[model samples]
Target: MNIRLLAFSFLISASCFSQGEPFRRVNEFYLKGDTRVIGNTILSEHATKVYVRPKGLNDRTEMVYIDIDADSETFSSSNASLDIPEGAKIKYAGLYWAATYPGAKGKQKTRGNRIVYDVKNKRDRPFDLVKLSFPGSNGYTQVQGEVIYDGMRDEIIELKNAAPYVCYSDITDLLVSKNAASGSFTLANVIALEGYMYGGSSAGWMLYLIYEDETEPLQYFTGYHGFSFIKPENTQELSFKNFRAVERGDVKTSVTLAALEGDLILHGDGVSVFKEDTEEYIPLKSRVRYANNFFNSSITINDQKYTDRIPANLNTLGFDLAQVQIPNKNNEVISNDAKQVKLQFKTESDRLFVFFSAFQTEISTDYYQRVVVEGKPDTIIKPAQEKIAEEIQQKETTSQENVQLYGKDGERIVNSRNAALAEMLKVPALRVPGMNSGYYVVNHVFSKRNYALKWKEKMQLKGFSPVRFVNPANNYHYIYLDYSKDPDALYERLLEYRKLKDLKEAWILKVNLD
Candidate 1:
C-alpha cells in the first residue's frame, strides 16, 4: 500500500495583519464548571471549575482566562491553566467571571454553581480575563468560520480554522471525563506564541476567532507563533493536525492518520522523532531522547520492543493524562482524513490493560468465528442484487434482533469495515454513499446470558456510545455510553471505565505513518 505524506513546514514566516484583522467580538458566552483554552475556541462543561490562584508558582497555574483583545477591559470566563508565552506573562494574570443579571435590565457578576479552585490566592485575585494575542508577523492564519478558539475539536468546535492564532483546547479530557473526550484521534498541531526574538516583527499574527456559532466573532489575531520570537539552535517544523499511531509492534507499526502520499517517511530509533519531507530530513527530537514516545513518563509500564535497537528506549509524549489541562477543549488526532479513535491507554501505567482491551476491540470477529463454528452463515445464497428482505425471508430467522446484529448502527455484519451490509439487506434498502459490509462468527455462551443484559444496561446509560454488536453468541461485558453529548464528559467517562476495568496498562497508543 502506498502511504501519502503531506508537506508542511513549521518554520513558516508569519505576519500580523497583511490583511485587515476581522473583529470577532467573542466576549459573550459563559459556562458553569466549564473550561476554556487558547487553542479551543469553544467553552466546555466541567465538574471542576478552573479558577486562577494568583500566587501560582512555576508552571503550576491558577484559573486561566482569556480576553479577545489583550487590551479589552471586560472579559469572559476562562480557565487558569492557559499556556501563555513567558513574555506575555506580567506580574499579574487576566481573569473573567460570569455577568450576573443584577436587575431585569441585564447587568451581571460572576455568580454560578460551578466554582473552579485549582489555583491559589483566590480572594486576592480580581475578576480578570486574559487575552491570547499572536504576533501579526507569525505565520499564515486561515480565516475560518466564527470560532473563538483554534484547537482541534470534533463535533462542538467548527472544523475550519477561523484565525491564525487559534488555540487547541486540551481541557476536554479534564472536564467532560474520558468517554466524552471529543478529539483524541487527530495529530496535534504544535501551537506556540512567538516573540520578537524570532524572525517576525511586533505587528504580530492577526487572525479572527469566531465564537459560540460560526456567525459570531470571538477573538482577533489568530496564528501559532514559536516561543520567544527568536529561533533556537534546534528549531524544527511542527505540524498540528498530523498523525495518530494506532497499533505498533516493536518498530513497524500501523497508523490510522491521513496520507500526504508523496512527501514524508517516519522513522524513530526509539529515542528521537524523525520527519523527512521531499528532499531533506530533520530530527524532530534530539535533546529530548526517550521522549516518553507514544506514552508519557508519568505512568511508565514495562517497556518492550521487538526490534532490539541498541538500548531499549522509552520516549515521553509531552502531556500527561494526570496533569490537569484546560477543561473541555477538543484536542484529538489531527489527521488529514477523518477517522475515529479512543483512549486505548491513559499512560504507560495502563499498559497490560490496554492489550486486554485490544483483544476486546477485535473480540467480535473472534467471537463470531467461535459462534458460527458450524460454518459461515448463508450470506449470499443466490445471485446479484440480493434484496435484504429476501436474505432475511430466505433465512429461517425472524427479526433485526434475531438475525444477530454485528456492527455500529445496529447492523447484521460483524466486521465494522463492512457497515454497508446492514443497509444493503433492507428491502427498499437505504444506502450510505461509500460503504461495504463484513461478517463474523459468534459463540453465544448461554451460561453467561445475563451478562448480555448487564452490558446492555450499561450501554443504555452510555447513551449509544458507538459500538458494533456481533452475532447471537458474542456479547459485551460493559456497554460504552454515548459520549457524543459532551466530549469532555466522554473523556471522563472513558477514564471512569478504565478505573472500573482495572485498566492501567499503557499510554494512549500513537502509531506513526511518517
Candidate 2:
C-alpha cells in the first residue's frame, strides 16, 4: 500500500510540473555600427541648428541649441510666445496646465510629454506604433518602436489638398533591424518607424526595430518583461522551478519574442522562482524546463484567497464591465466605445487608460483580471447615451428659446452669468477706447458655488469674473458682453466663447431690450 501511494505521488508531481503557459517567444538582438549622428554637411545648407545629445547615467541629457536663418524671423524664443521656428532644436519637457475649476489642480506626467506638440500642420500630432493582437475577448498590444521624432527636414513648404489628416494609431508589421549589413534580425511583433529607422545600443529606449532587407536585432527586452537567452554552459548548474503567481490577466510584459522549441525560460527578478500569490510562500527552483508535452498548458486556481469558498470554477459577480466612456464630440455626451475600427474594448479603454500609450488618468484604474470572463452586454448604457443625447438636444432647444434681441434686461445673459475668458476670448467693449457699455465680468459663474459675491471674488483670483448673470445651463458663464457696433471688436470678442461648451443645452442670446 505504501509503495503504491508513493508511485501515485510521483505521477501527480510530474503532472504539476508540466502545467503552465507555453513559452512561445524569442530574444531580439542588436547589431553593431548603426547609430548615425547628423554632421556638418547638412548644417551649412538647409539646417539651422543642431542638438548635441550626451550619453546619460539613468536618463539621457540632450542639449538643444538652435539658430534661425535670414529668411526666418520665426525663431525659438524670439517670439513672445516662444513658438519655436521650424528646425529649431528644443527639448520636449512636457505640457503645463492649471485648472480653472474648483478643487481641480494637477500637472499630469507620470508617462511623459503632455506639452502642446509644436507643429505647422494642425492635423499631424505624432504617434508611436505597435502590433495589435486580439487576445480572445479584447485587444492587446506589443510595442513596435520608440518615440519617432518628426524632424523639420521632413516637411514640405506647401501642399495641395493636404486637408488636416490626424495621426491615428494603427497596427504595423515593419521589418525592424539594428545594422542593415548583417541579416541577423528576427521579425518583431511591433516595430517603431519613420521612413528609414536605424536602431542600435544607443543608450536610449531600444524597444523594437523595423525590418529591412539587411538589419539585425538588438537587446530583447527594454525594461518591460521577458526571458533571457540561455547559454549552453549554464544549462546544468542553472536551477529550474515552477508555480509563481501574479495577477491572472496581467499581460506577460514582453512582446517581441522567439520561442525556442519547447525550451523556454523566464529570468531576472521576474523569474517564477519565488511565487507571490495568496498562499504560504513556496519558493520554486529559480528556473524550470519543460518535461514532455507539458510546454503549452495552464495553471488552474484550485483555491482563492479573498473571496467566498466555492467549487473552484472562476466567476465575476458585481464588477463594472462597461466603465469606460469617451467624449462624443458630436453628441456632447461620453459614450462607451472601443476603437471605431475595433468591435469592443474601446469604450472600456476610456476609463482604463487616460490618453492611451501609457498616459494614465486619475479617474479609474487599469483593469486587473485574475481570469478573463465575458459578461452580459451592457444594454443599460445604450439607452443612457440616447437619453443624454436627447437631453442635450432639449437643452439646445431651450437655449435658443432664450435668444431675444436685447430685451428689458439690457444685454443680460440669457443663461445667467458665470464667466471667464480664454486667450482666444477677450472683453469686446475693451476693444474700443470710448465705448460706454456695461462690460461686467461674472467669473466662473456656472461653478457649483451659490453664485455669491464672495465666491465670485474667489473666481476672480483665478483670472475670472465676479459680477453675475443668468448662470448658463451647465457649468459655464458669460465671460464678456458688448452691444458695441464695432464689428471686428464684437466679433472677435465672442470668438473665444464660440466653441461648443460642456452644456450643449445652453445658448448665447442677443437679449431683447425695450
For each candidate, give its TM-score against the true structure: 0.16, 0.15
Per-residue CA lDDT of model 1 for 1-514, tens digit only, reads 0111111111112221121122221222211112112112111111123222222121111112222222233332111123223222111111111110111111112348632212111122221122322232122222111222221222322111111122212222222222212211111112221111111100001111111222321111112221111111222222222111111111111111100111011112111122211122222121222323322211111222211111111210111111111111111111111112222111221111000000001112222333234455422111111232244345535555674657676556753423332332232312222322321111111235345444333332322221223223234322222213333323333333343332222111111111
Could you tell me how far off, in angstroms, the CA of residue 192 lies in candidate 1 after the best superposition?
A: 26
lDDT of 2 at 439: 30
Tens-digit lDDT track for model 2 on 1-514? 0000000000011111111111221212121111110000001111233222211110111111112323232111100011112232221111100000111111212335432211222323222332222212122234333321221222432101111111112122211121112111111121111111011000001112222112321111111111111222221011111111111112111111111011111112110111111112221111121222111111111111112111111111100001011222221111111111101111100111001111111110111111112333222122322344465456557754465446575674454333532321332222222323333322233444344433433332322322344433343434332233333333333443333242222223332211
Q: What is the C-alpha RMSD of each candidate to the true structure, in Å?
A: 25.7, 29.8
Best by lDDT: 1
Give me the overall lDDT of model 1. 0.20
**Model 2: residues with Cα > 4 Å off, grouped in runs:** 1-388, 398-402, 405-514
